[model samples]
Target: MAASPELEGTESPAPRGPRELRLYGLNAVHAAFAKRPEAIRKLYLVQSRIPALQPLLAWCVAHRVGYRVVEEADLEKLSGSAHHEGVVADVLRAEPESLSTWLRDLPAGPQLAIWLDGVGNPHNLGAILRSAAHFGVAAVLLPKHSSLALSGAAARVAEGGAEHVPMVRLGRTDNALAQLRGAGFALAATVVAGGRDVFAADLPTRLVYVMGAEGEGMDRELARACDLQLSIPGTGAVESLNVAAATAVLLAAWRSRRPG
Candidate 1:
């Protein structure tokens, strides 16, 4: 069946999962409050630590966000561990945007997007999202299969990037690539061998840089779909750069070339 553009950027309702909002560590909680305070529904702090949390408490109070000073054990229970560092916040999950919506929303200027073929690691995914936000990429595309969702770990690692960049989960990587190609995007896949150096490639403004999983690299179907496959040159001593590191390097290179 021919793929319809209807499903391009649509997101189904968030799946029902854990009830309480789970956020651990002081830094993570602080990041949410500072970057995306509207996501915070309630702030939980240990009674004895309220003094230490005075600044955060004041912000919550001023924002009219709910807060409760509970026992240490209660905070731990709420966060699912004792590593919360005496603070926990009930925050809404970051919403995922449709790929089509992101593409349409692109301003009348240069546009770039990153597509992950089969990334399963939350940290790597999060790091790439952070890089995309930093480089002003239009959006991030992930294959529905074998792709990690935007979890708390991803959000924490992104340091608020997850909230800024739109993330679209595709039903199939190959199909999504086809759609992107139809929309005038040049597909450039990062491969270990048999590809030009990324720096030498004629990466255009509307390019989709594809990065595959760490162990498997780009699959045959994905590699074949690429208008060009590129590699980040490295010393023979190391096999290749990690996906996240490669993403940063590729994004930086692309951004540097854009007309400023």
Candidate 2:
């Protein structure tokens, strides 16, 4: 190998911060129109394609929401992604709840929360957040090191849930679990190999359902910290269900068991 591509001076691109360019697709935009019109900053539509998006336009007009007719290129440029689906709406950043404040305000009754352990995928995180919101979860906690803030895809997938739910960034999983336990919430982790079936477990009134990352389940220490390790009953055909699907199942089961 004569001069195998010799290394030349190369500079890596600068790391980017949380997504500044937010694009809401058709479905997400429609949902915002119905639930959070005030959050929308600007709506961009193609003039020729106005007929297809009449409802959106009408809602914007009725709400006095500002909008503009722009070309497809402009939408792509603004979104910084090609999956905008012909409609893009710029929105203001939704206010986030402080982790300490959320925890401090817990009422003197049962509460439900979701803890995400090293869940790296934004789509999965977003889906789980949506499920958490649907079942009226009290809060969602994530280990600061392994989890990421809500992203554009997450915002889109979450629909309106991202705006409604509270997200907490705890620095360490073990410490977070300890705090939850002290607060009278039972910690339960979803495990694959050895754990009780979620459906049969007598879940406590206050619960923190800890979900692990894809492929790699919870770490041994974290699993041991859980008051119980639970598994979803499923056919043994697949390795394991996606984290998001499992989250929905567990959440639904938990919600059903709540006392009226």
Q: Which candidate is the best by lDDT?
A: 1
Off by over 4 Å in 2: 1-21, 30-40, 47-66, 80-86
lDDT tens readout by residue for model 2, 1-260? 11112111213211122323365566666666666667666677656767877877887788887677766666556565566667777666554455566778878787888888778787897798788778988888867665367766776777667766777777565666667777888989888757888889898999988888788877778888788989988889987889999999999989898845
Q: Taking the tens digit of each residue's C-alpha lDDT, what string does model 1 give over 85-121?
A: 7876777766556666665666755678888877788
For candidate 1, the per-residue lDDT at 65 reads: 84
lDDT of 2: 0.73
Estimate TM-scores for all models: 0.78, 0.78
What lDDT, from 0 to 1, does candidate 1 have?
0.74
In candidate 1, position 196 carries an lDDT of 90
Clashing pairs for model 1 are: 9-98, 9-99
RMSD of 2: 8.3
Q: Report lDDT (CA) for all predictions.
A: 0.74, 0.73
Q: Which ten residues in a row have the lowest lDDT in candidate 2?
A: 1-10
Q: Listing every candidate in turn, what is its Cα RMSD in Å to the true structure after a full C-alpha superposition?
A: 10.0, 8.3
